[model samples]
Target: MAKDNDPRLLRGAAVRQRILDEAAQYIASQSSIGKLVSISIGEVAEVAVYVRNQARVAHQLKLPFDQEFWGSDVTQEECKARLQEMNDDPSILGVILQRPVPDHINLRSLQSAIHPLKDVEGMNPASIGNIIYNDVALAPCTAAAAVELIRETGLNMEGLEVVMVGHSEIVGKPVAMMLMAEGATVTVCHHMTRSVAMHSRRADVVVVAVGKAHLLGPDMIKPGAVVIDIGINQTPDGILGDVDTEAVKEVAGWITPVPGGVGPVTVAILMRNATIAHQRQIASGWLT
Candidate 1:
């Protein structure tokens, strides 16, 4: 375990607080803002914890929040229809669709159904595409959170070498794109990569989101490299991140611990996105 006062360990409390503070200021300036609606397809113990955290942060920001639970048997068409109604409802600020939805439901299609402006999660195809144009104000929560932490390091983004492990749309892919938008030279590694370590070893910063506990170790990184472990895997011992925190921290210049690192900031990013969605809604004249 990393020592409590270890300077190398990057905890999310400060970053999360900074982001929420900015969000709170923005939200306070708004005259009328709608509630953030989180929709869950079915009861999942794990997802409930995430929803609770998000709700807690929403309350802290003083943003109206609502939760909806739909039956698991609902059809994909019905899900899309309900989302469309939310898009038209001025009282609804943004919509968050929880993951691991029923096997029969089309997740991507449902994401596309959410309007880009209200797609606070940035999972919508249109929202992801907007990153290519250098518009990252509204981006995937985890991806955006990762970028925010990297910035917290105070390193110059332009031309910084970054290696991203994993290629999932919600995290890896968007992160690479978001970094590039920040002027960082990014290389993304996946299962087919000849050797992930070879790339990570040379990177100034390495962001891992492969969802495998302890996949990265001391040997895989260069001395003093910034390590951002985005994975959250369950184990008998407890929750663990992709990087071996205890061992990697010895060699790493900085590393984010699993549960206290990216997870909290992710919830804060969601609230920030809500504020951005509110701004765009007014810009589009959808809300007065």
Candidate 2:
């Protein structure tokens, strides 16, 4: 419900583009020596969409990108072996495992098989563990995008009161850790929380990533608070976010829209992460 000219939207777009341009420039300067590879165990519509978008961005940046698809019957061992092979390959600067792998495969095991330096998606445990010591360069893309959007508000992160309404490893937990590292007092809530509104009402910033449509409403928000909706739920009407955008925008000082809000920025952050992974390889003398 934010106005079209909202500074957060404008700045997010500008930052995303700038990062993409910078990443593209870096890859070109490197003579496109490394490739960004995404491996999927099966054909998933959502995964395909994500990979296609990534390929498009890589194309614009002139980065080498490839997708590897395996049969649905691929075993966990096979997936891990492939990931290990990619991890050991110095020519592969970044590796990503697409989600929704077969039920039999151990996704975490495969994730762990990826070299921490090449985990561009930041799903590897090592990459996330580094965040505890404030090593944010390898943080997850969506979490990084949320933090970037909050920074766009020009608010002081130090001593900011933030309520993160999700505890998932992918988005909620990492975001809370990142916010806390920035000196924000963060309270993480999940399905077990008795009163979500109680915590959210006192927060200066509310980030919801629970994937439930219209879960956060106007009454749950503080006046002039920065609301970041990280949820993307496909409803009968269309795609909606966790917050009731129209109502929250009226009460909140700033709010991110469902479609145009976090998605684009998240994609850009992935490109930035890929570039960072490549840089780390260079610094470690893996790429000369």
Candidate 3:
């Protein structure tokens, strides 16, 4: 493992702090910002942890925060109705719908129910689609986090060679689109791709978001390449990222560690998104 102070490791702590500081300043300048409401459908431990992190950050940023834990049996209609209510409530600045809702809930429908101006998490289909037109101010949290880290590398984005090793809607797809919006050429590789490594080895930057642990290794990339590992897999050894960090570190110029890499930046993006949502709300006449 590289030393904690290793320059090769692209730890998210600094990037997270930069964003949080900006968010705090922005929130303080606002006349009357509304609370960010987090909605969790079931009693999942992971969801609990995520909510806690978000709430803690909200408190630090001095942004009002609220959360609701619905019973596992909450119906799809009930979820939509509550989101509709949040949409109408001016006190609610934004809404974050936690994932892995009860099987009975239509997650997509609930996402759509959140008004676009209040969709701080940017999970709504309309929100994600905005990336295609290059309006990334409200991109999904994780996808935006990946793009933020790449920017931290201080590399010029225009025409940068980027290979994205996943195609999932939430993370992979949006990240690719976001990168392309910045003028980087992005090739998305999925299970159907015959040679993911073949595409990655030649790229200036490689982003891996497939859920598989250690799916990317040193041999798959060229020396001095930037590797953004967006996967978080729980293994008997511990939580691991899609890229084999230690091994890949030897070859890649910069690599993001699993737990500390993209995770913190993701949470920070939520707060930043709230501020963006606030600005858009004022512009759209949703708030004064």
Q: Where in model 3 is the C-alpha error above 4 Å?
A: none
**Would you estimate the TM-scores of all the predictions?**
0.98, 0.96, 0.99
Q: Stretches of candidate 1 above 4 Å error?
A: none
lDDT per model, in order? 0.93, 0.88, 0.93
> Which prediction has more favorable TM-score, 1 or 2?
1
Comparison by TM-score, 2 against 3, better one: 3
Candidate 3: residue 197 lDDT (0-100) = 81
User: Between candidates 2 and 3, which one is better according to lDDT?
Assistant: 3
Residue 48 local lDDT, model 3: 92
Worst 10 residues of 1 by lDDT: 42-51
lDDT tens digits, residues 1-288, model 2? 456875433235666787788877877887656889988788789999999999999888887899899999988887788888888888788987889988888888888888889999999999999888889888899999999989888899999999999999989989999999999999999999999999999999999999999999999999989999999999998999998998887788888888887788898999899989888888988788
Candidate with best lDDT:
3
